[model samples]
Target: MNLFDLGWDDFASKSFHPFCSGDLVPARVALGHKHACELLSAHGELLAECTGRLLHETASHADLPAVGDWVAVRLRPDEPRAGPASRRRADIHAVLPRKTKFSRRAAGDDGGEQLLAANVDTVFLVTALDANYNLRRIERYLAVAWESGAQPVVVLNKSDLHPDPAAIRAAVESVAIGAPVVALSAAHDESVAALAPWLRPASTIALLGSSGVGKSTLVNRLLGEPRQPTGAVSDAVGKGRHTTTRRELLVTPSGALVIDTPGLRELQFWDVANDSLDSTFADIAALAARCRFGDCAHRSEPGCAVQAALEDGSLDADRWQSYQKLQREQAYAARKADPRLAREHGTAWRKIHRAQRMQQRLKSGE
Candidate 1:
């Protein structure tokens, strides 16, 4: 595989110079496993594991190589090939700086960021048009996608099931801000042509969505073969069982690199900054600009544009609530990431609690 086909460019070449002089070769991580990874190098596909020094020096798991990451690898010439079943193995010495990355909070209470895919040019936020259609979920995805620095395209899959796919696409477009919404049945070849613009040659796109949203099916369709296993959605719950168990990058027949991820059951934002949040909710941000106060919270304040829109029905109540919920969550995650901010927040809350208790005692004549 050509390195450029995997999204490599001058930025990657510049970042790779530090390790280029040695036996190190630039490879893109095609599949990331717990202990090892499959990389696409100039020499072709090879299995590689991170060097002990690389693992020990890393501050967090997010620093490790992920699917779609470009890394400096050293091929082990002395080690004999394991067997016909496995490719030659190498050691990944370093990961180049990612121009874009999709990430979410790690599952459990760790409060750590989990890198999903790196160096992706576009993200396909797939959602089925059936019972799984959810604007709120799409909004959440848009937040992370915006934070990732990648262009987000909403793919309304299973369009054949809907009588008016255009209507559904319009609805998605309303809340999607300026992001493009493409409605197509991945099962149909003609309909899938709508996605060709984003699947440009040499660009990397990642498919992301919940279970039963047909991400794997879309990958298969794009590949023009059943390379990825797909599952059927349950009639009762409209949810499909997990089929793609791991994140893997593949080259589509169209000459574009694509990453197919396992359907995400939970997607929590991790370290998303306020600028990205505003970009995701650009509609609200625009309305907020008309408010009388620059610092207006848009709640019960006089001349508050957001609240006025909510009252007059110009803005959606559900979307406003979703925005608020995400804002609070992002704020909390930020506080968690910064110990000083968390301490200040706790102190402020304690002061408010004390003031409330004092007022209560005075009212009761205690």
Candidate 2:
């Protein structure tokens, strides 16, 4: 098996220059389970583990090898080194720069974001066309996808189960803002060809959605076999139970590489670019440009173009509110790292609010 067909050129061109010059083996991590990894190297597929030195020196989660990280490994097949009897461990000397990384803030009180998948060229935001269909959730996923550097292609899976998949697609497309949306049934294998453009050889795509959305079934379809197990959806809730428990990269028969991750119940905000909010809420952002004041909050502010549009039926009120909520969340996430600065900004806002309240009280003589 030629590892070069698995997008090795990307790693070779970017990582090979500065680090190892002679007899260094470059490999891509196919799967990561705890401390063990399955690496596709120039030699062959090997059950690999990180070196003790690498593990001892690593302090952060990002330092570990992820599913898509390209690493330079020192191969020792038939020889044992002096330290602790070297047992074919791969020393991940360096990580290649990622083209695009999909990440999310980890659940709970920890403020740090976790990198889910790196170097993904495209993101398949899968959603079931059945009762699980939710345009609002799709919209949120779109924001997260835009925040990542990858292009998002919305996939409305389980179309065969729905009587009218067109309705769901239309509703999702209404807010897709020109993003490509495809309706297909992963079980029946129909219209799966529509995703071929993104499944080109060496291209890496990831499927992200809630449980029972047929992501695993879709993975089986793409692989042309039942590589990932499938589970039946609950009869009561019509939702499939969580089947895929880990993020593993699989190579399809078409030679395209794909990473299938476990279902995500909560999609949180992370390090979003400044333009991501504008791109996700283009309608609101564009109208804000025409506002009378340069900094219209769109809240009860006079001459608020966004509020005017919402009131006059030019823009959907619900959609506008959703846009505002996401914008506020993005703003909060941006300031989350600097707690001190956030507190200072909060104090300034509170002072402004108090001043406004005092002015209103004086005007009414209350």
RMSD in angstroms, all models?
3.2, 5.3
* Model 1 agreement with the true structure over 141-243: per-residue lDDT tens digits: 9999999999999999999998998998898999998699999888887888889998888899999999778888899889998877677432222243332
Clashing pairs in 2: none
> lDDT at 343 for candidate 2?
90
Report the Cα lDDT for residue 11, model 1. 82
lDDT of 2 by residue, 72-110 (tens): 777765555555533355656566666677777778876
Top-lDDT structure, candidate number: 1
Candidate 2 structure lDDT: 0.77
Candidate 2 error regions (>4 Å): 10-12, 56-59, 79-89, 232-247, 337-366
lDDT (CA) for every model shown? Answer: 0.87, 0.77
